[model samples]
Target: MMRFFTGLITVTLLLGGVGTVWLFLTPSGTNLRYLMADTLITTQHRSWAKYIIGQHAMETRVQAYQQQFNEMGEERDTHEIHPDSVPAQAPAAGTNHEAETALTEKKPLVEIEEISGHGYSGYVMTVNDPTKIRIGVPEKKGRGERVLSMAERTGAIAGVNGGGFADPNWQGNGFQPIGIVMSGGELFYDDLGKSKSTQVVGLDDNGKMVAGRYSLDELKALGVKEAVTFQPRIIVNGKGLIKDAADGWGIAPRTAMGQREDGAILFVVIDGRQPGHSIGANLYDVQQIMLEHGAVIAANLDGGSSTVLVKDGQVLNKPSTKSSEGRYLPSAFLVFEHPELAEIQNVWAGLKPGDIDPGKW
Candidate 1:
């Protein structure tokens, strides 16, 4: 009997070792490693995971691997557009005759298309007029609202997830935005130090998509009508800011906003964390897609479970969350026929940060 037990234990140990080796050898396992590393770095001030793996070393290794794969130049099921295919000159900053001409030319006001790449599939929505876009804020101060609810309430034709929010233990109410939230040219939330700059994604008064680091005064001076704070601008001046996939904030569900040379807004949503469908997409993949679609400027939005797309009062993309709709959010970019007429109240008025506790929800 002792011999039998010893044999079983040995078999179990061998199987465990084999399983570990097999997992590391698989593409999914590679993706999992990067994803875990990214989450650890972003969510924590100082991560033990980074200490265990050596943050710099892990990043270097990932970048090298990605670079090697890119050098291969092998084409798989990728829908990427070659850099040369895009026009040499993008539209000038702010609205101009070129932008007007592009708008007058033939193109649907809103176009939704399926986008697929080497390892993932997703959707992109293109909006011709940037002025039609506006931010939808919840009515109450300390709570959150779903994108669908905000869309229906505001009579929006389409909506997509907006800024990042506070989520304690990944269980917060999503009521508090990390930084500022500006709607209709009004500053609704500001948590940064005075004169400090934060990366914002929004539209200026000229109806052009504006994304970059800016202070509140700078944003106001630029005539930013709608804005949300989020990080790591992926593209600037028709150039991909991210070097490679390794630097591309690890693969997961993603939401990004961009503008074409013609001033068309691009909303991208990629589903992740669901195997057998779409594993996920990195910032590198997103940059390529935006370039292929003619985006000269782009920035990442709040992704993960908050990544979602809704059109015509229906959820368009499959959100990577247990909730079929999506996690409640603080804001959403809602599209309307006459945005100037849409009424969005200032919900956070008269409330201070200390009054809110996201974890309670």
Candidate 2:
């Protein structure tokens, strides 16, 4: 019934020449109501029928896009776009694929495949080798989130807000957060609570490296105190304090400990060799691989369907390829313009620590 009425309205509106006005005037989410409210009057030209028919066409368009949004699940709930969504405000010059990757010799990762979809834009700071990547998560956070929390920044398997695992905020009307990063060695961890030096250095749309709260000491304490390993191994600091901790995103929180052979401690996320996730890195597999990579301390980030990497402008590893469920994350470490580091610092000056809110899966 809905489909039949919608089609009729669309044809009538297109013929009436009011489609443009109707589309522009009609706000998102109001289309469905407009369609179901009124009846058609074929002979009534320039009247309510035109308005009604226009609304129907717009409603149909919205539903079509809804399906597309579902395909890009992460964006389903993020209906209202930020100013940054439009093409008017382009990213910094070098942040784009060509400019960012022009220095192929300097940044190999930026020149490879690109995956600039996930509410982010990146630059390859120093892709010395594929194994060692230094990603930077820029400052563009979600609309409702106050600030990107530690859980989000670390790419946890669950959202910190109300989705995924469920929270009272969204009223259980959300999906699970499934996000992760891949590395070969255990990375150091710390807390940025008290210290001010070891701050967050990321970008703002204008190509700048902004500062963040917490010093190296603080980060070291909060990020990594212990380490563990999983497939595609690396080291991650383990010590994210969740007062009401339920799941450590994916892996056990304690596993993110130990050092590596090269002494480059990075985090690693491993997963079970299941059918859809046949290539994933898991704990058991992580231990074996990290041991080979000389990983002494290793911990898993969000893995399984969450495993992801962006080289050039493409998603390096399959990010939830098998699962329509995108990786639910609270935060991430994307790479952007280090040249604008000073600019980023300026933005940081006006900010406080822990300003970004965590999202629900």
Candidate 3:
């Protein structure tokens, strides 16, 4: 009996070793291994990914991804949206007067729907009038504010997280943004100089979604009303840029914004990291969702633990953070009944990056 038990344990160990070798060292498992590493890179445990792949290999992979994203941003968006045709639900030439009046009456400007993919579930919000969307920032001076707070303070009907920021050691106070931030046709914050360019995602004065790489001067020239810095325009000119799931930047909570030809804005907020519920989505998945909803242009926003959707001052999506309130974000795209009247003050108006302390409360 002792000899039999010893043999069984040895066989089990051998099989485990073989399985590990097949998973980590074989070409067939390259995607899976890289997916694991990429997912880790989004989290605070980025260094843990080096255990799966060697340190040098991990750095190479990350750099390659950065290059690919930069190349994607180089492609210019040549599409334009007509905001005048957005709410064209008017009655035809020959219709009853009462019915026509009813048709002319305003519909709900914002519509929220539940959306689910392979291993993720979240919400897709459709704002009929794109011009009403504005970027909301914290009113306080020292720290960032939550999406719910931003929406409530600005009297916005709905809101979602926006842009990347300087989050050092993943414990940042979310006070500092990474690149340029323009709100209400004013340059609110800019880390890049006048000549240096960065990838931007926002809407212009005509309600046209402006994305891809642009300098501060170019953004101002284009009349960008609400702008923030983020990555890789996934869908441009009515085509998906991400080829497949492998290049989809390894599934995590994703918040992306898009626009249809008719000038309706689409916001996709996906939940992730919850095992039994939602595991998250990659860029390809987000692109597919936007395309299916008739998006001609789309770009990713600040996601992961920061991804949250708020409507009427209520949290709508499941945030992956320890607190259900979601992370305090530097900026959020908010929808208002009259966005032009929404008073969004520039919290970082006179302050430079060195003036703000991300660790301070």
Candidate 4:
């Protein structure tokens, strides 16, 4: 009996040692290790990633990603869109006669289609009229608002979350935006000084999708109507930036915006972290999706737990939050029937970066 027990223990130990060596020494295992670390960096438990990849290596990886994103923004985007060619309505469901009649009638303001690839699944929302898209903010004074609430308050047809903020320990109030926010062709918030520049994703006066790095003067010259600070324009001039899935920052929920040649705005909301339903996508996956959908220009938006889609005052996608509603965000891209009528007041009007407390609820 003792010999049998010893033999079993010896076999188990041998197997465990082999598994440990394979996990640490193999290329595929290393890729997975870094991937896990990258995903942790996006969450509140960022420090835990050190166990997988050392603290120094993790910091180096993050800095490298930041540099890459900054360089991507530096490349000029010279794409243009003409909204006149875009079909104003969805095609009728069944017959040719109905389709002919529907062509003349006003089409649905937004069209949503389910998209899936590899290990991820999400929705793509196309706003037929790019001109009717605006950045909606929170109604109250202090805290940030959910995308659903913003859509409901503005009576918008659809919306997706926008930009990143000061989320101290991932429990930020969502009131303070990182760089800049522009709404209704007005400068709502600006932290970048006169000479500095930031990567921005927004629309110009002609409803052209404007993205990439630009200073205050450049944004003004382009007549950007609705803008928010974000990073890494993934596609520009009809070319994908990230080379492959391995280079895609990490596998996590993603939100991205793109513009077709016909001037329709595309919003991609990918869900992640859920085991069987979705594992999420990387930037390369997002870029490919945009290119497949005829995007001439595309930019990454604030994602992860903040990824959400709202239509007709109802949450359309399953948000990966404890409440399933999504995180409080400072800005959202909302589609309105009469976007000019949306009353989005600047909540950060008089506050400075130092003045706001992101940790305060």
User: Model 3: clashing residue pairs?
Assistant: none
Predicted model with the maximum lDDT: 3
| Model 2, span 261-317: residue lDDT tens | 322322332222233433232234344444544433333333333344432333323
| lDDT tens readout by residue for model 4, 1-361 | 9999999999999999998887799998899999889888877788988999899999999999999999999888888787666655666567597677867786577999999999899999998778999998888767899999899888898999999888988888898888889999998888776648999999998899999999988999999999999988999999999999889988889999999998889999999989899999999999999999999999999999899999887887778899678999899999999987888898878776677787898
Task: Write down the lDDT of every candidate, Cα atoms only.
Answer: 0.78, 0.29, 0.90, 0.89
Candidate rank order under TM-score: 4, 3, 1, 2
TM-scores, in order shown?
0.78, 0.31, 0.93, 0.94
* Candidate 1 error regions (>4 Å): 1-36, 39-106
Residue 341, candidate 2: C-alpha displacement in angstroms:
5.3
* Model 3 agreement with the true structure over 136-189: per-residue lDDT tens digits: 998888788999999988899999999898787898888898897889999888
Q: What would the per-residue lDDT of candidate 1 be over residues 294-332, giving only the tens digit for each residue?
A: 787888898888988998888887887788899889999
- Segments in model 3 whose C-alpha atoms lie over 4 Å from true places: 1-8, 84-105
- How many pairs of residues collide in model 3? 0
Report the alpha-carbon TM-score of model 2 versus the true structure: 0.31
lDDT of 2 at 128: 19
Q: What is the lDDT of residue 59 in candidate 2?
A: 51
Name the runs in model 4 displaced over 4 angstroms: 1-8, 85-99, 103-106
